[model samples]
Structure formats: structure tokens, C-alpha cells
Target: MVAVGEILLNALFQVLFDRLASPDLFSFVRQLGGGVDSELKKWEKKLRMIQAVLRDAEEKQLTDEAVKMWLDDL
Candidate 1:
């Protein structure tokens, strides 16, 4: 009984390790821009837009409450 349990446990670990090391798993992650360079490029455009909005708000001082609220909603 103990030997059978040990065999099952070893088989379970082997299967788990095989799945974790599979290329398909890595390919799926890469498709979602898991790479550092790809992830940064993905957010670059949004970051630029945010920076521009902040600069504009600072320069204009946003005296209008309605406009300020609209920007805040964003």
C-alpha cells in the first residue's frame, strides 16, 4: 500500500512538472505580451496620453469645476 502511494505521488509530481515546463504554456504567456519589452511598448501610448493630460491641466489650472470633474471621471 505504501509503495503504491509513493508511485502515485511521484507520477503526480512528474505530470505537474511536465505541464509547468511545457512550451505551450510559455507560448500562451508570450502571446499576452509577457516579455518585458512588449509589455512596456503596450503601455507607452497610454502613458504618453496621461502625461500630456497632466501637463495641460497644470498649465491651464482647470478653473472650470465642470471640466475638472469630467477629467476626474476619466
Candidate 2:
């Protein structure tokens, strides 16, 4: 029951996170001329990978106590 709630919350948070780093937002950031957009693109790639891992982990967490603990620490 608790894990279901936690997963739901995490899914919601993931939606917010995915939006914040969207390509359109990054394009806008690039137009602003910070030169940081390139780095942000790099980060977006890494973050995308992390997101994928997290999604898998979140699913795994229901059956793995250690996975749940790891996510809680994050």
C-alpha cells in the first residue's frame, strides 16, 4: 500500500521533471545566449538516462526492499 503511494508520487514528480528539461525549453534557453545551453543539453542526456534507470528501479522497488530504501534516500 505504502509502495503504491510512493510510486504514484514519484511518477508525478517524474512528469514535472520531464517537462522542465524539454527540448522546447532548451531551445528557448539557447536563444537566451548563455552558452550554458550546450551543457544543459549534455545534462539532459545524462538525466534522461537517469530517468530511465529510475523508472526501472521504481518498478523493481515493489519487490525489492533495498531498492525502496535507495529511492527513499534520494
Candidate 3:
């Protein structure tokens, strides 16, 4: 059986893919001046979530003692 961590990671990856593959994503982004503010806002939110996940994963793999100490506050 697959581990829970693997399952959760897969789920998160799926979410990232779905957000990036949104049908009107690029078009909406390109038309930045044409009332695409809402789409851009949504995109920013998703990007933030993706960044957070990536940051967490990277921190977990750190061998630098100082970096791990800094991540402790997060």
C-alpha cells in the first residue's frame, strides 16, 4: 500500500496541475487590461499555494543547520 505522505503529495501535485491547466488561464492572463483582474487574482492565490508547498518540501530536504533553525519558525 502507498504511504499517506505519498498520497498527499500526489493530491497536491494534482491540484497544482489543475490550477495551471485552467482553460482560460493564459488568455485571461494575456488580456490583463481587459477586466482580467479577477482571473489574475485567482492565479496569484494558486501560485502562492504552490510556492508554499515547494518551500516546505525544500526546507525538509535541507542539511544546513542554520536553515533548519530558520524553518522552525515557519
| Cα lDDT computed for each candidate against the true fold | 0.54, 0.75, 0.62
Candidate 3: regions farther than 4 A off: 33-74
> What TM-score would you give candidate 2 relative to the actual structure?
0.57
Deviation from native of the Cα of residue 4 in model 1, angstroms: 0.5
Best by lDDT: 2
Quote the lDDT for 40 in model 3.
62
- lDDT for 33 (candidate 1): 71
User: Candidate 2: which stretches are off by over 4 Å?
Assistant: 1-24
Candidate 1 has an lDDT of: 0.54
Q: CA shift at 60, candidate 1, in angstroms?
A: 74
lDDT of 3 by residue, 4-63 (tens): 554576577677767666767766666767757676677668777866765665556466
**What stretches of model 1 exceed 4 Å from their correct place?**
33-74
lDDT of 2 at 53: 81
Query: Which residue pairs overlap in candidate 1's backbone?
Result: none
How big is the positional error of residue 35 in model 1, measured in Å on the Cα after superposition?
9.2
Q: State, as a TM-score between 0 and 1, how close model 3 is to the true structure.
A: 0.39
Residue-level lDDT tens digits of model 1 in 1-74? 12344346446555655654567865776777748446544555555565566546544545766645554544
